[model samples]
Target chain A: MASEMNDKNDKRGRLENSISKAGNMSGQNQNNPSPGRRKVLKALAGLPVVGLLGLQVLRKTNYDNKHSLQRQLVDELGLSDLMSSVKPVTASEGETLRIGIAGFGVRGGQLAASLGFMEKSEFDKKSAAGSLDAHISQGNLNVAITGICDVFDLHAERGIAVAQHDIFTGGEIAKKHPVKRYMTFHDMLADKNIDAVIISTPDHHHAWMTTDAAKAGKHIYTEKAIIRREEEIEPLYKAVKSSNKVFQAGHQYPQNSVFQQAKEILDRGMLGDVSHLETTTNRNSEEGAWIRHLDSNGKPKPGDKKSIDWKQWLGNSSYVPFSTQRYYSWARYFDYDTGLYGQLFSHEYDAMNQLLGIGIPDTVVATGGQYYYTDFGDIPDVLHTNFEFPDKGYTLTYSANLTSSKFRPRSIYGKDAWMAVGGDLTVTPDGRSEKYGDMIKRGLVNPSAPMIEIKRGALTASAVDAVSSASTRYYEDRGLVSTNIGGRIWDVNHLHLKEWIDCIRNGGTPSANIEKAYEVGVTIAMADISYREKCRTKWDPVQRKIIRL
Target chain B: MVSINNQKWQTGILVALRFLIGWHLLYEGLFKLLHPDWSSLGFLAESKWILSGFAEWIISNSSVLNIVDALNTWGLIAIGLGLILSLFTRIAAFAGTGLLLLYYLMNPPFIGMGHAIPLEGNYLIVNKTLIEAVAMLLFAIFPAAHCYGLDSLINKRKKN
Candidate 1:
């Protein structure tokens, strides 16, 4: 313990020294022109040439062959027509599911808004509230926000307002459905009127709330990285299973059209025997890096701490002084959250994992430090984690740099071809595919052609406006419903909530169900362990515990 | 000194050339990658020599432009790093030569076909780009830079 304290002291001292040195170096670099500085300047000067060359190559590559290859493969699999007509599988019209929002925070509000409560002005002009109105009018899978709970009075009030349709732009607004506000989640769970709960509380509170809700015979739609620790995962999953209640983890990518198409393309085995998958989370703003919304003075506004039940908000965690920064941006504190692993990489892992159905990795090796966002956060600004799944014959890489957004679209590299997924799905064939000369001659594959790019959804100015300033665009883009359904845009959050609510009403499983959530939870837990312990983390299937290497 | 199997002085000269050309190419690629707004439009647009029409057409087409941009950026970086690090030195030199040759042929510092971009040095149908391509060609022929690079380390491991 003494040595650990000493080590901590040493790290703090080193951090201070480095921060000062970095400041000094910036001013000193121009005059002294150190080797590193010179090298960087030279590299910077050559950028235009390289960018031009890169652009030219991208333009010149003939994608005709690759497109033909995809067409042939997709046609063979009878997915050619389905690819164009792909839509979120709507749940059969059923009785309304009564949803009790346990955590009325940002994500909780977004989820509620997505459930047809968002201010219509926030909706895209073309999308028309993400086509949620039509879905709500369909009456099947309709969700009535019966209860809203939050320790913070402000959050609770805001949630109740949105649910009651008092904060929206609808034509008529005489509260037909008055949503009840609860001070504690337990009260909401006890309300027999509530059929389900959407757990969007801080990372620390997820486990207990989800398990408790399950035990209460209520379905759950929880946020991503459902729990903070590995120990909580099994019990949480089991509780839902034992209760026989629908528990959907909030990983919204499964509702995305591009991802759906990518999955379809992968299912066709077009990207033959995928060996490598790379995903990235990058943003270049304070808001993007979990700094939370700040006031004009650049300091977080201390909320009504007197009104907020701070003790309950802390839950199992140790007590700390009331700080709005901690309450709002809980992601910045290790005591409350799993940092980037749970917040960002969990989404990336779930997206790729959903596409491939590859479970927890054999080993996780991560190296990162709080290099940039050192203001109040313990989480690293830059993180790179590699997961090796030898059994699956593939390696997954997750990299993020809050400092820069230069990485290309995340992709799956396979023997036959590589496919990238972002705003669109693009598949490029490898040169080795030329070995199938007959296929080329038969017009099934184009050896020298460029890649096949499929634009799955349209972008909306409103969508960008809604998210870009919030720094949640990174989160939105990764798993949000960016796909069009029946020529109308779908809200991924809405789709995810609908999936949960639908499953609650009808007997079906959600895409981000408990089983899938466990895999994602364990993977993220491994990443957190690897980063925190500064060691290679491996999962022992036999013991179901993290082993250090 | 002129022996085909081994010549210390000749090898030294080639290694220097390899490193220099590699550094140039690698530096150019890295710069472009780091710059967000960097594009090949001006370079491709100002093509006044042979293949100018083709270059202009490539610029006009969005898909083709994107493809060319990616290829030019990555190809230069790949070839540049390869030459600099002496990892796959011959292949790197060859690829660099090809890129340089294309640039030369596309604009061909030929007399009377004045480029929109200002030239650094005067040339009689041969400019700095052509000269560098020639150097890259020579570097490709004498592949001895691996003696001090990552390739050498790999070779040693294989031998061991």
Candidate 2:
């Protein structure tokens, strides 16, 4: 502008002035006003850039529209509330309940830790390994571990150490309530110091212990299978129901956030007439086959005939020699448990029972034998059990492959869609569907891919582990039954215990109360009886007993 | 200081640079505006450099995170419009430089930092972010907006 004003006679100056005035929409010949058309052209020059960008964005997003399809399906299914389904963890109110732990072994150790009584050595080890999230996330359920009973002295000692020195919640509470070691569960139940009991003993002791605890005026949280034999189901159920005590079965699946999302998907009828649920456990490892006597490096784990009270460990099960194998891995023997049915399938059954409320299958047939790992245990290495709920119009099948670690998704086969549930939940629209038929045909939903995926990663809890072995990862991921609430991944087992404690302190029924536990017990018993007899076992609802045919 | 021998061409090239940078920022703002799920969480979460603690603090609080997100989304849009229309381009350029510098400091591609987020290309200490921030500073120095922009229309300049 300075040059143009000073040297209007120069041709270069004139050229620059004309270009600037025309293209840049500035003052032309300062004394002469610019034309309206020139000003309008310059003012609208930037619009083309924005307009081109908008068109390009539309074209790009259309090509990569998978997210839109997911959004559309989620919107259609009304599953936007799935994330918020995990209600925040409310602190257990009222008096802090005094609880006793019966048979504090491996599962018992986990239960104790989840309840916030993690021992110093164990806490340090987990903290060093960066795996103390279960305790770290669940601070205090307001329940104190007053007594710990175990037949094995080593385990009892470990439990005592855990309950004594483990003071994460409050040092005052820990000091005020000193933990005691009970040689027998009856002694612990007899003591008025104990108000509630966590039955984490072997499957054989669950029914009797739960019954005894209920009779002693104590609330019970029994670990599944809940019963080993068929006769104990009704008695335990009646014992729990007759008493005013709160009973909760330790099946974390039903209370899991993933299961909550799956339940929502089912409740919405998004799957559309689900007729089958395929439950599977594929493990190719020594540990999965109940070879628990040996350590990871194939060494015999601690506990001798002197340190362990073998007679009491045998309990009501028949007189057998005190073999360390039987003592450590009791789930293998028919005298102790139903093996795969009682161990892994019990979780599958309980989850199904809670989700579908399809309880006490009319007929159950179990097949397969101890094809491998036969030298040590009676339980089969490869077992396939089919449970038919004819009235409910669906069949639940469980395939346990101890020798093969193939990834067969635990899926519910629905007519319109299939929901594969695990640590994460995914719903895939079926290629041939009555409900989503038009969606599949219109290319809005790709049938091959999962339309809706809800991933609640428990990175701190269990998702990322140092042991990357397939079986180890699978089991760890399965064990991570996490309840994520407001970006906090809670240990599902702790939530399960929290629910029980809440029921005991407050006046509400837990998710896995007596009714739910009884249904699970019957189903598990049916599967076990069928497996043992090598025949079909039918449930007689009128008699409330399992009959073989 | 640029030579006065070829003033028109210098102004022309500088104006072109302004529009190009303005176009890039405008699209960035528009893309984030269109995607509802787009959040600064992932980027802040991967903050491994100087401002990592601040980044973590932002992420740990949702309210702070929301404020940062809103400021960034709208700030880019405002700066982008200003630069493209050559209206208050110097202030826009300065603000753009400051924002870009903050992003660079949050997750600089220095050796051994090893960012988990995938980038457009492998970068050392001097990445495109640093270069773009420098370019924005140059725009402020050259005053391209006043030479041929809406700023010139509002504040017409002439020599006596």
Candidate 3:
């Protein structure tokens, strides 16, 4: 305060004092130099500080340029395409395609949101909260969710509410669609009003619902571990193939921009003679293990015998008494799902398939036990499965544990470099790599850290699951993930659905089409049989069946 | 020049502070300039407190984000050079204070608002950035740069 009071006076006094010291200087005389050399040196003293800062900055820049392995490797390996702009996927504009959603559960809701349907309540909250996550990409495919089929009435109503949301369709004035609920998906399939059906029902219902939906002339987008049992694979395959219906098996990873980059890295052989792929699922929470009947507050979630049609939910699976355990966490039971295989391993397998294009494995050996979560479902809390692709000399190892939410990244081991891919992609040059030997020896590529790293959203809309993940649920438990579905950014799941919708309208093969679905289906069946039956299962491609050994 | 010899220590301290702050901000700007991939999105994404809404508005728009990013880098560089060189020191000091205040507000050390992004020092609304901003305001009040600043030479030819 004291300094401020005399600020103007001090400035005037100092200026006059300096001019008086100069003795011959005047304020208007711009050409006048200082009277003394010492005074002149004081005025020019800022140059030294500028010099020091410049020197330090140059040193730092040199250090960074020297250690930048990513730049060197990308340039050398011709893998710069990984960092190139995301290849544009054509979202063909067309007439609105009416669709029915089966099973409006957790994944069902996610799929619907990805398909550009946000429940009014959720939209209000998500837009308010994650309104800044621009990666959500605001535009929607010209599609409408007119039908919702769920065994649980609450879920059906929720689905109906979501289907009726019209704000996100370019934020236009509310365009109301007559959304109806079907007690069973079969009824939804029978409706001529529905052009496609999204089968997000529990794993047991997938094969039948997808086959039925296809046979009924409705395009199908069914979620992963498409068929829980070995027998359903052929029928599901034949139905989709014979019906000529656009069957997009439920997987959204391929739509990720990073996935394309990862694929390019593999195609360019940046990894160099990849022999093994390691995928992992780690979770410490009950919800992560599919013990989701109870809410976060330890309260039982909404559902009951009266509201949920148990018989219809059971479907072809053997009748089980009304239990919230089966209804909420059906993935934990052998009757409905292959537990980890259906829930999480399917994503790992799908990611591996999409990256390597390695189809059905020759032999799959599964081993693990219910070492944790003893009070709950029959599925193992710790599981490990291996798929040997003899023809490609490739092996896939999937290790999952429900008790530890540690960051166990999924890695693909190649002779040159091993790539760890998740929410971000990192390709660490192997110390003993044959292909990168010269580079590592010359210190061009560092062996200690990844030479090539593609951070999510670096290329384009990196919406998790659609963007990057191991996937997101098991990746980083922090706010590195978001559930918002609004923005000008490309959401991967939205792109996958758009691809399905486009294929339906324009007739092109979507990445998650029937053939890939069949490969994944057989692989899941083999792993399931190997886990449950305590045997090693081998795929006989000629016979189109897995032979137990 | 009358008080120059008498207030040498005080003026020296003021000049040293000016140079140090200039060096710090200049390095920050230079680092961002060097790392082409560096974006304020990470910092803004984890933004908390009063400026978070403004941060979101910038983040949601890529062009706006780019503009903000470039301005932040260049603004820091220009202010830093100004402070060190004592060239337009008052404008630089005031601008520096505003920029520091933005940093302080975006991730203010207020309780419950400081945990999103891990920071270097702990503070109770008195972090180093806030201190720096106050110090910068001091420069706006005082002509410390006149002791050995390029502004002193220019001021010799004009009114304050």
Candidate 4:
């Protein structure tokens, strides 16, 4: 730290010397303007009046040219307010909420074990090489898991084991209050003991389960891409609203710290008038592309299919030949998921929405097709979306490639400065601001010199790190969870779950509620439709539905 | 240095310098004013100088920005014409110097602040802006329009 300060001081000295040297050579310093030069400036200031009078005579020309310059720059640039703050709703101490786990998939497993059900030290034993140790926080939630449900017995058993503290790990485990395993979501919902149900199932199952849970008078936390079809949206929304249950969408990016800071940055206008924003989600490797892993023998776990209720797992999707790959890697298929739109693009969209609050786009044009990872899925592996909100005078461009892990950190561009919003928010002012005139005149701020880079989080820039490739780690670095809290790591998922619990107790909605998800749902649906139909899509505010353009 | 033989040459050189700089400024202003798409945004945005914050502020706010853009576009034309035709040459020269000073300050060719732009000539603190500003200062101090330019024509008419 001391050395860095010294380096800064040295650079400052050199800059000061350079500028002064230039001033001396110019025969005048900033302290004094030559007498004749000063006199000329006084006379020239009157030219504004003359120009104004001339403008009045050429009113048509003035009017025509008025928007031509300023408007074009802003429009071409797509500037808008980016950082808008939303206060997170916290829970108050009340009745111990009985929660039910649904789906028991990758997302469900993570959520259940992560909610203080699985011990951090025990979970750390299963961590991949170089992964940080999870934090052990006591006095977190006073909630109880009453029931667990999943079509797959393996997932349901695992979720139940974690919730009931039945899982055996390397360390000594303690017994916790048992949670009953429900073979069906309906059975779980039927139990009056379960006050809330966290539906982390496949994309297709989200709508029905959520609506069912809501109708059953249970608070809901459903995963992203909340509904696949347009038909499912209204019913689910009505169900949640009519039942007056707190419905939290599983778009957890809002819980991240960088997004929260982004709101503050936009509020401060530190980046100047934001014009454009670009976000990219890139992933490489077969595993990264939602390919299911095999057991130690490099084969599907023995009798995996036999343990799962295949008919129930298929849900509303058309039935086909039973395959373990289809059940495990359901994300890669269109019948169950919108592929990139549901899995990745939804994340980017919601994160931007959280920061800018631009909501739905005025128009969206989807591009790209199944480029890489083409063998398995009908969905596009590489997708690009250009969302234009003309009234707001900004454009949002989202592009993702599953073939390459080189992700471009999301950024907001302003007239004066541009900022990168990712795991850590970095704000760098545009070099051309007139505020730097004196420094430039002195040659202190070299035109070709590297910018004064400012960063908040330890993550240098949004680059793909193989070890940190897990979605949870990405969210953690992005401020969804605590990277390290006194040597213990915390997950934002836990925080999000805690928030929902708190809100449930206090009779409020979580930060990411149903209403915001509905808006995002429309946009995501439009993106998918636009991609598949090969057309532009428009959102009709009056109709509250997507209109194909 | 102002001997009878050298006086005419000096006056002629000064007048030529005045005309050349004036023409450049005038053309720049007129071209910008005529081109509807022309904006100072890029220049301001691309500014790598010390006053970058001020330049950014100017571009960020639309109202202040429009005024600045208009003032700059018209100011250049006014100063150019004033110098070339010898109408208020003193004020024009001073205005021209001030403008150059602003440009120089915004993108100084200092040791550390080497602009990414490819400069035509080697400069040590004294670039084109400085040279033009110094020349304009000289024009302000010595009114030479009486010798050849329109100011002299006006002076002769006044005498008549």
Best by DockQ: 3
The whole-model lDDT of each prediction reads: 0.73, 0.79, 0.78, 0.69
Weakest lDDT window of 10 consecutive positions for candidate 4 chain A: A457-466
- Model 4 over residues B49-129: C-alpha lDDT tens digits? 678878866654434656888999999998887876667677888889998899888888788876766778888888888
Supply the DockQ value of model 3. 0.36
lDDT of 4 by residue, A287-315 (tens): 66787745546687433557878888887
Model 1: CA > 4 A from native:
A1-79, A82-85, A88-92, A119-141, A166-175, A296-299, A434-450, A465-467, A470-472, A476-481, B1-160
At residue B153, candidate 2 shows an lDDT of 53
Shift in Å, residue A288, candidate 4 = 1.2
Model 3 regions more than 4 Å off:
A1-70, A130-136, A171-175, A458-472, A475-488, B1-20, B30-36, B43-71, B85-88, B94-138, B147-160
Question: What residue pairs are clashing in model 3?
Answer: A137-A487, A137-A489, A138-A487, A463-A467
Off by over 4 Å in 2: A1-75, A80-86, A124-134, A137-139, A166-176, A457-472, A475-480, B1-160
Native A-B contact fraction in model 2: 0.05
DockQ of each: 0.02, 0.16, 0.36, 0.02
Please give the distance, in angstroms, between residue A362's alpha carbon in candidate 3 and its true position after superposition.
1.6
> Model 2 chain A, poorest ten-residue lDDT window?
A458-467
- Judged by DockQ cut-offs, the docking class of candidate 4 is incorrect
**Per-residue CA lDDT of candidate 3, range A1-549, in tens?**
888869978987885454334422222255545545645677778889899889887886788777766567667887655556356655458888898998999888977887677788877775655452442454557778899989899999899888887746444434577999987777887799999999888988999888888889998899887998889989989999999889898676777666777788788788888899998888887777778798768888889999999999999888779999889978788888889888777777888898888899999898999987888879999889999988898899999888887887889998888988766778898899888889988888888987877666532223332223333555332212332222235556667888899898998899988998888888989998999999999988788878999
Candidate 4: stretches off by over 4 Å: A1-92, A119-134, A166-175, A293-297, A301-305, A434-489, B1-160
Deviation in Å, model 3, residue A528 alpha carbon = 0.8
Give per-candidate clash totals.
33, 0, 4, 37
